[model samples]
Target: MPTFTINGISATVPDGTTILAAAIRIGVEIPHYCYHPKLSIAGNCRMCLVEVEKFPKLQIACNTVVTEGMVVRTDTEKIRKAVTGVLELMLIHHPVDCPICDQAGECGLQNYYMKYGLHKSRYDLEDKVRKKKVQDIGGMIVLDAERCILCSRCIRFLREVSKTCEMEFFQRGDHSEISIFPGRKLDNYYTGNLADICPVGALTNKDFRFKCRVWFLSSFDSVCTGCANGCNVLADFKGDILYRLKPRRNDAVNQTWMCDFGRLEYRKANEARLLVPVLRENGKAAAAAWEGVLSTTALRLRDIADNEGPDAVAVIASPRSSNEELFLAKKLAAEVLKTENIGFTSRTPGDRTSDDFLIKGDKNPNSTGAQLLGITEEGFGRVVKAISDRKIRALLVFGSELSDFPDSQVEALLSNVPFVAQVGTNEGVVSRVANAVLPSASFAERGGTFTNFTGRVQRFSQGFPPRGKAMNEIEILAGLANRMGADWKFDGEASVFRALAASSAPFAGMSYESLGSEGQVVAEGRK
Candidate 1:
């Protein structure tokens, strides 16, 4: 351990900790660029200069490792002068496009200028060097060379993190600017991260460009359900619509990067959503009130369970559902409906589309969670076979579509079943064939836990309300259980999770509050 004093505050930290990191540890703010913790330290940006006791000149805090008895000052007049000089030089040729820039509210250069350099510009606005305004880079990123500060964060991320070396600085001196090769464009699975690390308006996501100001959006810590990796993410929503999904720093899972597929998953929450309940009348699906649909479906299911026996009914749970939703679905089938033909199906397309990075072969995010809840692979096969054999007269599905099953098998199954009730966030093939379609909240609009492929039980909070008449899966299940004469009570996701933890051995001793934003890993044997 090394002892260092940052602004009269003494602290001991491990060796090799940089002065910028040490200052941060002691609540000393050091303005910086090109110093991402996960990316390689490129000390090209001189914004983080700090004064040391015995140093002849200000040292770049990012590359300066702390030493025993080292004293550092970040708020001195000399350091402020140096930082102001650095910012002035960086802003000399930079264009004044803050009014039209997408990163106006969160740009690092704008924030640093307000903090360090609040003086009049020495150069005329007409003298600013003109560069390309908007270049359509591949992989959902737009480049504006005029707003770039040349921090090298995007370049380092492409080279070191994504390993896609498609960009570099061209020319020398003041004329230098970031550009791609003549024929090459920035195209990678993780290319969206370039805009995330750019710090300035130079690089921006094409999908989210000029959609909404960053300050107007409310953010919630959540997890990506694009794959079983369950990468941590921040969901940004405004006016009941999800605007974007950014990767949140979770060193245990996705270090500061997420695949572009997961980053764009928020669009589904805004588009093509199921908003209301529908029921079949005269062979046509029509919108119906929630009370009418729920009461009718409950009566129909009760009749089948009484006359045809519980074995004639089948429940198909989806791997896309959360752990709490899966637990309640299991309880609804086994305890309430008294059916033994309950199982879950995976939505994984194939292993060929998977990569060595965050994208997993298993497309479903909570398959491991479904498995822990006693929903087995063989059980799903048996249920499907029973449906095809015409032994199952009634069917209940959660979040899965008819595409998850074989086309020929599910078509026959759907034709034979007299009553099919489906709950999903989107209107798909299953919902079309189902006699009753109940709209359920999407992952972004619900709060629950998801167990990743490695048995990590991460929890996510609701970012917005469900679309239209859609309800959360937990509430829908609890309503159904109560209608069936069961006394199951659930106020919200937390209460349901507590009850699940109390009943299941794997989830025992775990609570929703205990599973923080970072998540806790369940033991391997339990999985």
Candidate 2:
């Protein structure tokens, strides 16, 4: 460790640790726009200038490596003057559009200006150089050159982190602006990241352009359900409406970034939502209450299991469901329904593409969680075959559309069953063909844990109450099990997870508090 004193506070950091990273370790804030720890240092922004002993001048904290016995002072008057001058230059041609900017509340330039540069403009605002205005860039990003400070965070992120060299600076000096390469668009799987790393309002997401102000949105820690990687994210929503999903740093998993596909999966929670439970009445759908839906579903499931045997009633679980929900589903199948004919979601639609990076071909977020609970995808085919043969007379599907099977084929196969109950977040082919549809809360509205592809269990909090009449999947499953004469009293996700941890050997000694924010990797090999 290299011992150093930053602003008179001592910190001992590892070898080759930069001054900024050392400052972070000691909880000292060294403000900079282009100094993202995950990316290569560009050293273009002088916002992190700090006075160091025995140095002729202030050093940029991002590039300056700490050494043994090194002494650094960041709050000196000399450093303040230097940083104020740098901020003045950065704002010379930058537009004062903070009133309408989406990044206003959380923008680096705006925050830094209030702190350091409150100086009046030397020249007329009208005389400042104007670059391109709101120009539509592909991959769901809208670029506003006038708001750019040329810190190169987005440029560096594209070249270094994403490794997609599609964006570059064009023209000279005041005219220099970020643009995509000719005849090519910024069409990568991780384009949303550019907007996330943009220090200013230059790069903005089109989906979240003017939808809601940052201050008005309530954010909760959540995991991305778009893929098996289970990237951590902040679910921003308000009044039953999910606004957006922003990547939350988890170095063990997504590492400060996530794919654009996962970023846009917030739409599943916001759009085409199933708000109420439904029961088919003579081939037509009718709105149903929780009591009717659960009672009818329980009675039918029991009748099928008793009349046609336990093998005739099948339950299709989903990786999209939480570990608690899956555990209850299995318990419902084995204890209440007394059936071993259980299947799980194998593949999801549009989950076929992948890269060596974060993208996983298996889009289900909790497949590994399902696996840890002894639920495998191998039985899904068998269940489908039974459905086709009309041998499985009753079915309960818990999930969204977490399979790649054709909607028509799913409807055709499900049609053979006399009592099909779909318990899911969205209305799809399975819901359409089901005799009873139970509206279950989406992932954002459910406090649950999703074990990623690597068996890392991460917990996500519920952003808000479920939209309309939809209930948490765990609640629905537990209620139905209780109705079937199985005692299930779960306080919340934690209670069921404790049961899971106790029952599953691989997940032993793990709980929500133990999982924490970064999450814990499961013990290798299962029970």
Candidate 3:
């Protein structure tokens, strides 16, 4: 342990901790660039210079390690002058494209310039070095060499984090710029992270560019549903439109980076959305009132349950659904509907699309949550068999698409089933075949928890209102349960989770508040 005084605030930190990190621990701000905690330290950016007692020259805080009884002043005149000089050199040849740059509001260069180097530009605008602007770098990133400060964050990220080594500094001196090797491109699964880690507007996400300004958008913590990894993310949206999904720092899961697949998955929330309740009659689906749709669906299931027993009704939940939704689905089947067959549709059974990183073989985000609630993949085959045998006359599907099941088998099963009720977010093949299509909210439009592959129950909040008449799965289920004479009074997601935690063994001692932004990992045996 080593004791250090950063801006007169004394604290003891472990050996080898940099002055920049130590300063951060005690609420002292040390302005820096190219000092990503996850990436290897490159002392190229001298913006973090600080005045160290007894040291002749101000040292870069990022590379300077704290020693016992060390005194550091981060806001001294010497430190300010050094930081101003560094920032002046950084912006010497940089373009004044702040008005057009996508990263204007969040750009590090702009921030530092206003804070440190507020001096008028000594060099003429035409005299500024111009390289490339809006150059199409591979993998959803655009590059502007003129905007780069050459802090090497992107270079180090590629070399260390992604291990791609696609990016490197080319040329020398003021002409030095980031570029990909000849015939190579920045095409990695984690390439979108480069834009995220880049300090300046030099590198920008191609998908997010010109879409919306960062400051105008509202962000809320949510987990990515692209896979079982359950990468924590910030859902950035404006009004009802989700603009992007940025990786939120979750060391145990995604470690400050998310794959491009998951980053772009937010687009699905806006595409092919099922907004209203639809009833299929004579192979045609027409928009119907929510009350009529739910009542008809409930009556059909009740008839099948009363005539052929509860086993005649099969419930197929989605692995992509939240733990609260899956728990309620299980409760509806076991208690209210009184059915033995209750399971979720496995999206990627025996999937091989996994990597050494965040991407998982199981495409479903809440598969572990479903399993925790006693729903398994084995029920998929059993329910399909029951449908084929004509034993299951009624099928209640939650968020499962026809593509989730074998195409031929699902088609055959749907044809045989007397009544099929589907509750989902999007308009898919299953909704077309379903007698009653009830629109349920997408992950972005609802609040619930998703248990990752390792049993971490992470909570996500509603980023926006449900599209059209689409309600959340909990609301849809609660409405259906009430229609069936069940006294289920779930006011919100919290209440439903409370009931789930009280009744379920795996979810015991867990609540929405306990499963905060980073999430809580359930005990191994409890799950």
Q: Give each model's whole-structure lDDT.
A: 0.87, 0.87, 0.87
What is the C-alpha lDDT profile of model 1 across 1-527, one tens digit per residue? 89989889899998899999888777889999889988879999999999899999999999999999999888999989999999999999988879999999999999999999997889988788888889997898999988888999888888888788999998888888998878988878998898899889999999899999989999999999888999999899997899999999889899988988888788778777789999997689889999888887887887899899999888999898889899999998999889999988675433325788788877788999999989987888898789878888888888746534565556567888889999888866677788998899998889999999888999988888898999999988888888888898788889988988998888888889988878988855787
After superposing candidate 2 on the true structure, give the runs of residues whose Cα lies further than 4 Å from its correct spot. Answer: none
- C-alpha-based local distance difference test score of model 3: 0.87
The lDDT, on a scale of 0 to 1, for candidate 1 is 0.87
Clashing pairs in 2: none
| lDDT measured at residue 277 in model 1 versus the true structure, 0 to 100 | 94
lDDT of 3 by residue, 256-351 (tens): 999988987898789999999999998888999999999999888888888889999999988888888998899889888899798766664334
Model 3: clashing residue pairs? none
Please report how far candidate 2 places residue 9 from its true position, in Å: 1.4
lDDT of 2 by residue, 95-185 (tens): 8889999898989988888888889988787889988888887998998988888888888888887788889889988788888788988
TM-score for every candidate vs. truth? 0.97, 0.97, 0.97
lDDT of 2: 0.87
- Candidate 3 Cα RMSD (Å): 1.7
Error of 2 at 133 (Å): 1.2
